[model samples]
Target: MFAVDTSPRSRTRQYSTSSSSSTRSMAQRDSMDIDSAALLDIQRALDIARNTEGDLDHSVEKYLEEQLTGVWNRLESRPNTYVLSKDEFAIFNYFVGRYQDSKVAEKAIARFWSSYQDTGSS
Candidate 1:
């Protein structure tokens, strides 16, 4: 036979012992995952350290150029209102790193320009 609660009002229920134990187990697993992730990051850092400075710089430049091409094209299509700095590649790098997608980075650049216009600040 199945019995149902027929209370007139709903009330907060306390956590059961099993559920509490499960919650604790979940927290432990989460911490373990974080630890493993940190270890992986350290390994990657060591691998990068083995590379020479020129190799690292070349790789970074290659990545930035590959990622920023679409972003540059998008900026090129915009109206010539703001005097943009042609050498300002850092902003493109920042947005690309933040989104890691050309389309999304283009959209973010559009929004940035929109906000700049709205602010009316030179």
Candidate 2:
């Protein structure tokens, strides 16, 4: 649901592939290409923060303003998803702005939902 185009959603800096029939003595290794959604988020974040002074949360907020609704729509559709947490805003800002990768942010949110367990303390 996060991917708006026909592209991947996430990627890592490094990846490895085993070589069973390679002439080289080492395995093949390369950097994974980032998805278009993440790339777009990066570009948009940069554009938003270009003239802003200090406080990256604002830029993140702007980015979220454009994408949060879509994400929430998906989350709201599923039962037992999107638990209310105290760190919600902080988590949102970090994922949405830290690396300017919304695709990862989306994935992170989904992950949090599945892994979240209420301790019944707060």
Worst lDDT window (10 residues) for model 1? 11-20
Top-TM-score structure, candidate number = 2
Candidate 1 lDDT tens digits, 48-106: 32332323323333444443454455455653332233222343644455556556455
Steric overlap count per candidate: 0, 0
After superposition on all C-alphas, the RMSD of every candidate to the true structure, in Å, is: 20.2, 14.7
- Name the lDDT of candidate 2: 0.38
- Candidate 1 residue runs with Cα over 4 Å from true position: 1-57, 80-90, 93-122
- Can you write out model 2's per-residue Cα lDDT over 1-122, one digit (the tens) per residue? 22222226431112122334333321111101222223334334434344334443332445544455444454455524444232333334434554355454566566565445333334
lDDT values, one for every candidate: 0.38, 0.38
Output the number of the lDDT-best candidate: 2
TM-score of 1: 0.25
